[model samples]
Target chain A: MSPQSSVLYDAPGPRTRRRTTIAAVLIGVALLAGAYYLVYRPLEAKGQFTAVKWGPLVDLADPNLPLVWERIRLGIIATLTAAALAIVCSLLAGTLLAVVRMLLKEQAKRRYAGLPAAAAYALRGLNTALRGITRFCVEVFRGLPVLVTIFFAWRISGISDPLWPLVIGLSIYNSVVIAEIIRSGMEGLPRGQREAADSLGLTPFQAILLVQLPQAFRIMLPALISQLVVILKDTTLGYIITYEDILAVAQQMIQILQNPIQMYVIIGAVFIAINYALSQLAAYVQRRVSRVRAHKPAAAATELAASEPVVLDA
Target chain B: MDVLIDNADVFVSGFWLTLQLCVLSATGALLIGTIVAAMRISPVPSLRWAGATYVTLVRNLPLTIVFFLTSFGLPELGSNADFLRVPGLSSVFDRLGIDLPYFRFAVIALSVYTAAFVCEAIRSGVNAVPAGQAEAARSLGLTFRQNLLSIVLPQAWRAAIVPLGSVIIAMIKNSALAGAFGVTGELFSSGQNLTSSGGNPIIPVFIGISIGYLIMTVPLGIFIDRVENRRAVAR
Candidate 1:
């Protein structure tokens, strides 16, 4: 038994140990039988295990192997290209939107004692209108499915190239999501950071831009990387729009080789490998960030006490 | 406006299908996710390994690839060749007067994909329960299963509700992919059909489809916020 199991149960006695051993063996046998009956037999029956199906992907000696790898390489490039563009766009736009919303809220609260009453009222009205419109856009884009947004971008923009629409659509949806992440990250910071910025005579916009935003980005690095993984995964949706990303390229190969199962399995494994690596990076960053905070115990304690709980936005 | 009015039936039925997809997939995900969570927390090393492997593999793979695998791979395996011929399973579906191979495939894909996230959410919830709770239960001579069912899970579920709501909401959006991958009459494909063949203007058709999704998602988003706020207050 694992150490973690001790939380729920004590070390087993002889009889309990034997019982657990028997249970484990039973589960092992069941798992093996299930795998054989549900997976191997059916796949074998369809001759999916045959060398012809696997050769292009796995057999170094196969004549088609080089071409297959080349296509896969190109496909990966296309996928990364789209994902990178979308990630950059989303991050910049999302931060801008977050900052704008924050500033608008600040403006709404300010008494504007130095300004005339009519001018102050006009400024407040503008702030409210901008806030309302911004909120509506964020909510709409966030609520709509990324695919639907891509379709709308594709149709409305009359973009013939699938990559632009895919990028635009991903940007629109992910920007709002990232905005929420940034907002939460900012909220998670100690209130004193904002106060310090204010004491230094920085305006609300400058304080956010110089102090809060950078710290939020640092604190939220792990989450941002995870979101990158999400964007990378979503780039596959370009297949629906006929974008020649890796998945679409795999489909074309399947059409040629008549090996849908093998092709898809390969594609799925590729995705898993890339995304797993990205997630591991996110985890590493999270560990490093926390460790840095741990070194500053006094500051960390105060930060923790003052910070609001940061719930991940979906 | 005219396009939306003229095609009201399409939008309604499309969203109805989307709702069905979400409901079925959510139920399947919860069931499988709970089992996987149990496996992960079990004392047996092999079960823990199996559960970890399942979650890792599924979580890393894209939902689109999962959909493609089910749409193409299941037929090759002969599992979904004819849903009506699957013996005991067929009878249940037959009695319900429904047999949709593509829809079933899509549900399988969504459930399998979403179950990974659900497992993580549930495990986090379990982790949120203080160690003292479990230790106390063990000291009281409650067995692992009894302790989990009575003490751990009851509290874990309360913490899990917010994350689960988010997962379900994401599932509703992810279900849009099913419409593209041969599950017709869902919001996406209906919009596609209207714009391409029904001679409706593209903007209105998409706007109508957007509303269909928002109607499902927005309220759920609000409810989750409310629940989260209440939990914060309680804490």
Candidate 2:
């Protein structure tokens, strides 16, 4: 670090400087030695650091390599398809959940407003029941690991598509998370938005659907994209169930090719690339949203009718 | 339900193992994460670059890849099993009653992957510590380490409570993946075993397993909320 210290603190005194220099050198040496021990030396001992292990990967010129690429292409397709299905399903499920949770609270409020003798009692019962069910679904799905959720879906899933289990599992767990994101986004809006809707003669439900939700969903787009990346990553879990996705394909090929390290590296890099592209797409969309909102603030509500994805805080 | 009762031992142990994995991994993650967070906020440029690179690389990668590296990849190269036998570590493992090689790999994978998230949380927490606090510490003639350890980290952790809680809950859910890699006596594997064993009625087994997880995860979440609320009120 430069001795040109910024506002956080002044440059270290002579003793402090010597101590920091010694500490930095020690940490640097430790880092280098740790890397060598953990990565370089062990792999070298196993002959994994040699060209023999990596040469096949470098020979992209071979004509027969297209067959291997074909399997990888298919695996990538399967992984993406599963992620797409899960993302769609989760968004639908999450919006429904957020709305349901909201209505449950709203129903409780109305229950005490003296609607009627029989109807109030029925509504009370219904509200209590709905509240229990919603809370259970949200908490259980949220609390359960995604893999276990997938395991359950795999066991029960009777669909023809082999990926149904993964899709269902991802949707259930992520929707709970997504619902929280969307609800929090709405909750974050200024109370003035709702008061304006009320003054404009919109009912609470209409205000939620038209005014609050649209705004929240817009603000939530970036977070939603990040969650989609998570879903994409979890698609690798499909390997456990013997799903022939990209990761599974790599695992299978690694056995035949005897290049586990190289295969997994390639697979990991593929995932990183795809996810990085998705993140960039999210950033681009965020910029576009801001641009549109800035250009014509009045038309944003109408023009943004489509449910752009909602973002989570994470 | 009958399946659940018949395999109560499996479910109970699975819950225990999952809980053990979460606790150990969360502790390891917190330690590693704090160091990385310190590196991130340090005055050293190289340290900051190293920290940033780690967060970027690991955060973008799938946890499954991490699990693969530790479980399958490491074993392929050589054995780190001897490290587990170190007196201090082994006795801790003995107390936890988890001896499987897979459990060790799971702990390594889960903690390493989780540390990236935890580092981000803590770095943000560090950033949230008002600049004035550091200035005040400097004015008090405290050393840089003193400023960080005494003045900064305590408040950083407070700022980090919610995100760190989410990371812990996420870690709990994530520990279930250890089962896929042949970590016996964990929730996911136990559920998987029920199916392969035949005539076990798999749906209820998994529902039971999810409930086992909820037993661990929900309480942690509620506890974090209580802590956050308490911290807020104190401030």
Clashing pairs in 2: A220-A310, A220-A311, A223-A311, A223-A312, A224-A311
lDDT of 2 by residue, A148-170 (tens): 88877877875545698888988
List the RMSD of every prediction in angstroms: 2.8, 4.7
| Residue-level lDDT tens digits of model 2 in B69-144 | 7776777657644464557665655523345577777888888899988987876667667778878888999877
Off by more than 4 A, model 2: A1-8, A11-30, A111-115, A279-314, B88-92, B95-100, B231-235
> DockQ score for model 1, please?
0.62
> Cα deviation of A38 in candidate 2 (Å)?
4.0
| Tens-digit lDDT string for candidate 1 (A161-277) | 999999999999999999988877787778888999999999999999998888888778888888898889888898888889998899889899988888888888988899889
lDDT against the true structure, per candidate, is 0.84, 0.77
Task: Score residue B101 of candidate 2 by CA lDDT.
Answer: 75
On DockQ, the leading prediction is 1
Fnat for each predicted structure, in order: 0.70, 0.46
